[model samples]
Target: MKNLIAATYAPMHPDGSLNLGMIPSYTTFLQSNSIEGAFVNGSTGDFVSLSTLERKNLIAAWAKDKPKDFFLTNHVGHTNLNEAKELAAHSQGLVDAICVLPPFYFKPKTLESLLFYCAEVAKSAPDTPFYYYHIPVLTGADFNMLDFMKLAVEQVPNFTGIKYSQYNPTDFGKCLHFDQGSKNILFGVDEQLVDSLPLGATGWVGSTYNHLAPLYYKIISSYRNGDIEQAKLLQQKGVFFVQTLDKINGFNGAGKSFMRLFGLDMGPSRYPHKTMTDKQLALALKLMEPQEIAPLFNTSFSVKHLQAIG
Candidate 1:
């Protein structure tokens, strides 16, 4: 959880089967861009649709050539506690960390119950650093993270921190500074990631990091150098990237397909998530070119595309 962790996609063939072959190229692509790690089977990776074996295969493939300094986290969250524990157990000697979002189906009603669920899964893989994926917007377990961590300290032995995907800056800042900076809260919102800099966030786990790590790193440097305007503009480009792709079909599928522009063919997305057409992708690149967010990518496209495309 140190550098930008790309919330990776489950590569697929056009027929909607798992395309495990794309991972090596993907790993090289991320390393080339300084992305540092892969956050597999999370929301971006479409964990819910994957079978237990599929998830395990993904972890194994990505873990094969993982660099010593690279960070690799597998999202082991599932609707079934048993399945979650199974995945956590599966990830035991593989990933650097194992993360779990609250079970969205049955859903935990209270923070304590959610912590109870987390503790159960964490204990399965006692050696792995466990992170609670605090994405309340998706999971409906919208309890306070600071409160969660406080209880976690007393409950879960392997509890590490959170993959906070909410937008509450105050709560986020509080979590980052909690226990005299002992909490390991990785910022999740891409548009407001720069705000986390002053709060001392060195780690982030987000899907957009898959596409915009360079731009984000530049934004961080710009913010540090007092170029607030430049930083704000870059952050806005990130927002623009989301808004644009989201408009085409939906951001998840469209963005997944857009990875082709970077040489990683993630192929088609799974059910309920529309994969982009060639015509659609062409239009997307055309629309994106006007934004001038070139530095956001490793591609030859210039980072100076848009100043106010918003």
Candidate 2:
């Protein structure tokens, strides 16, 4: 079975404060939906908009209540190297793994520079598995992972693999085959999952997994069962799911708000990320109805009951 890690949202209060109280129920929701893991504080979590202290508190809350058999990969990448290291150290004994993104503002001009940044952070958590976040569309440090992995294997003692979010199957394929497939390269593109299937993607981390785990696993099952057309059809529904969220407000905001329909209020997105009103959320759900996507949503957990226990 492929490991499906959901890139979780930073649950907040209506006042834009961290709602650490919501995490226990959040875990229940993911576990009930059959999500295998969580990739916290990554792009979907709005990491850049959060203060360093806030990020620390959020991950700590998650660590305190992690379910048995749940894999937590805390993303500790920051624009500031020292802060990133501090987060890495904080996560050392708390999470199953740690990952870092290249500094985006003064991005690494060469592969060596990026590897050096990863090395410094990896040293902070020497005992934990380390993964380099390769989302060049956001970081602008788009070095080929095939080349990155070659040197990373030789240099970074704890370097494990990458969270590949880009759309380069050729490079991803090569990396998957490198060293006769030792490293754990998790695919990060949700909609392009069907495409990565042929390349041997055994692990995936993405935001849509939060709401669509069953649909995605079905896509994989269909493919492995030699039903290629059914797999493609299901993957198209995944694409439609993203488009529906993107059309209403924006993906980050609307998607977070959409969680409420499943009984988990993710609160509002921070500045620059659009938030939808109750009316807008209704419209988003209605849009999903035509694609038959809305029927597949998970609504097994209750936030209110969880909060009462907490």
Candidate 3:
């Protein structure tokens, strides 16, 4: 969690069935490419589209005898409180942490209501550390983290941190400094990660990190060495990577398909998510080539070969 923790994609068959078999290779790929951990069954995994059993299967596969340092955080939040609690309870001995988006459908209006939802899920896995997934765009629950930190600390005993995925630096800064900087606020926006480093962010969890770990590590190194131009330039490649795919066939769908370029074919995307054609992937790769990120997509390259070159 200290560095880039990839919010991993759901591996699937052509018909969109879960493909657990890819995990062994998946683990090896992440390790070799310098990805520290995974945030499993999350937005990147299309958690909302998955059934309870499907989600359970995903957690089970990822949690089963994983490498000791290959941390797994399960996103067990569900619209149905009972189902969420069940997932939370089921993940007790399996994961390093559990994160939950607010119940987006009905939505929590007050601070207490949000805490109540989190408390229930937290109670189910009392031994586990609880991280509130604070992606306001998706959840529509825009409760201020500064407020959440105060309330969560008082009530949720295992309230460890937040998967902060918004653009509001003011609230993010407040949460980061809450209780003298004890909180673990894992930044979630891949495009804006460089902005967080100056704000004292140490950990990040994001979807693009799955494909661009070497690039991000390079961005971190560049920024730390007072190389702002290099850092910004690297980040723009990610921004372009996302923005370009988003235009052609939606980022999630095309991006999932783009994993094939990285030696991990995640299969076709699910409903409301389209699969990118080979032609589309070719177009995407063409754009990435100039940025020098195209070569790092495949695992055939060695770790020694992965020197960041953007």
Q: Find the candidate with the highest TM-score and give its number.
A: 2
Candidate 3: global Cα-lDDT?
Answer: 0.87
Question: What does candidate 1 score in Cα RMSD to the true structure?
Answer: 3.6
| Candidate 3, 174-195: lDDT as tens digits | 8999999888998999999999
Q: Could you tell me which residue pairs clash in candidate 2?
A: none
TM-score winner between 1 and 2, please give it: 2
Tens digits of per-residue lDDT, candidate 2, 182-241, equal 999999899999999999999999999998888998899999999999999999999998
| Rank list by lDDT | 2, 3, 1
Model 1: per-residue lDDT, tens digit, 1-310?
6768899999998787888888887888888788878999999998888999999999999899788878899999999999999999999999899999989988999987898899999999999999999888888888988888889988998888899998887888888888887868898888788777877789888888778888889998898899988988888889888988899989999889878766676888888998987678667667778788654666433223322122
- Per-candidate TM equals 0.94, 0.95, 0.95
Which of 1 and 3 is ahead in lDDT?
Answer: 3
RMSD (Cα, Å) of model 2: 3.5
**Model 2 CA deviation exceeding 4 Å by range:** 299-310
- Residue 30's lDDT within candidate 3 is 86
